[model samples]
Target chain A: MQFVRAIVRPEKKDEVLENLSSGGFNAATVVDVVGRGKQKGIRMGDIYYDEIPKTLILVAIEDADTDKIVDIILRTAKTGTDGNFGDGKIFISPVEEAYTISKGTKGL
Target chain B: MKEIMAIVRMKRTGATKRALIEAGVAGFTAFKVTGRGKLLDHSEINVPCKEKLMGMAASDVIDRKESEEQVVTFLDDKRMFPRRMFTILAYDEDVPRIIEAIIKANRTERGAGDGKIFVTPVNNAVRVRTGESGDAAIW
Candidate 1:
């Protein structure tokens, strides 16, 4: 199994999640975080911030579902029409194992 | 000045997050992140290190900018299973509550294998559909 981490602009978080849930991949985890991407943070007016808040969406999927899941995330989080800074980013990683606590079983 | 992020340890994060929301947080993002700090198998160097794709997203009103900081909360589920990692992002106002709830959910004492929480600042946000501001766009 493969785990996908989508680091996207905070604004696009909802849209992404909505898409994921509707796309049949509703089982996952959500966390709020702060970090920067290639843009290395953002600048507004006279203010310069170092860290940018981002949403990390975590989901474990079958090896075959990896490509489609990533595609959906990108499509949902990508800039739609209005220009926006910090569009966000997504990363894929390996999950050593997964478990359902109530069941006390391991899924890898 | 620093990026805000969270590293939480728990199983079935979907449930933990639902609990946090009830505890009071605007909203959050999560990644399938993986990592080991204490019991991390330090024996292997290039042992194909595994890590979860962990991160979080937060936005604030233009006036409440100073409140942004790295929010860290730890959660623990003692079952002798593979440890899970998560990163949380939220405004400083809700850190205490989130931590409290996370601690409660993990069922940890002062400090166990639960996890840690951190926070940081966000640069800017704009609605992709209507060009709304970050706070307005996301929240």
Candidate 2:
């Protein structure tokens, strides 16, 4: 199974969750996150802030389902049209094994 | 416009999840994450990718799949799609201790694993049910 770690604009969470759920990947959890991008923190008028907040959406799916889920997330999350700074990032990685506590069995 | 999140590398979080809940992290999410960090901080991975090139270029791979373009598409079409993967989320103040607990739990099995923690800020938030604010939603 592949795992997705998405950092998106916090405001986009609703749309993201909606798309993910409507797309048949309903099981998800959202967390409040903070960090900065290559912009090395943002600078508005004159404030020098180092940390930035982001919403992290975490989910796991079968290999066959990776593409669809990614599409849904990107469509709903990617904000800047010209690749602006800190538009958020998505990380996909492999999961070695999974276990369901309620079922007490390994997930395939 | 601020969020508090932490990436804590832990050994297989069998019960650590439940522990997080008990610690007052009402609704939390977790994913099977892998890191080159302290090997002691490991989790059970279900699907393993033999060949992997992560970070910046990974995004480019998504945009370049179709059409006649040597440079590839700007936005990769397959980054967050299938809505499948490993991940978990929790509240702010709940992080430090929870991750600490996670690290402690991992340490029980492995010793002094190398790992780094990161925290980032969020711009806005919406609570699906009643449409609450970030602070009100979690705090």
Q: Candidates' DockQ values?
A: 0.03, 0.04
How high is the lDDT of residue B134 in model 2?
66
Please report the candidate that would top lDDT against the real structure: 1
Give per-residue lDDT, candidate 1, residue A84. Answer: 61
What is model 1's DockQ versus the real complex?
0.03
Q: Model 1, range A16-71, lDDT digits (tens) per residue?
A: 76677677775555567887666656679888776888877767777899999998
For model 1, the superposed segments whose C-alpha errors exceed 4 Å read: A81-85, B1-139
Among incorrect, acceptable, medium and high, the docking class of model 1 is incorrect
Model 2: per-residue Cα lDDT over B36-132, one tens digit each: 2111112232112111212223455655433223222212222222211123344555555555554443333222222222333444567788989
Error of 2 at B28 (Å): 16
lDDT digits (tens) for residues B65-122 of candidate 1? 2322211112111112234554454544655566556555655332333444433345
The 10-residue segment of model 2 chain B with minimum total lDDT is: B45-54
Share of reference contacts kept by candidate 1: 0.00
> Could you give me the TM-score of model 1 versus the true structure?
0.44
Candidate 2, residues A1-108: lDDT per residue as tens digits? 776889998888878876786687755545677898887897888996778888887776778998889888877787767655776889987654443322223452
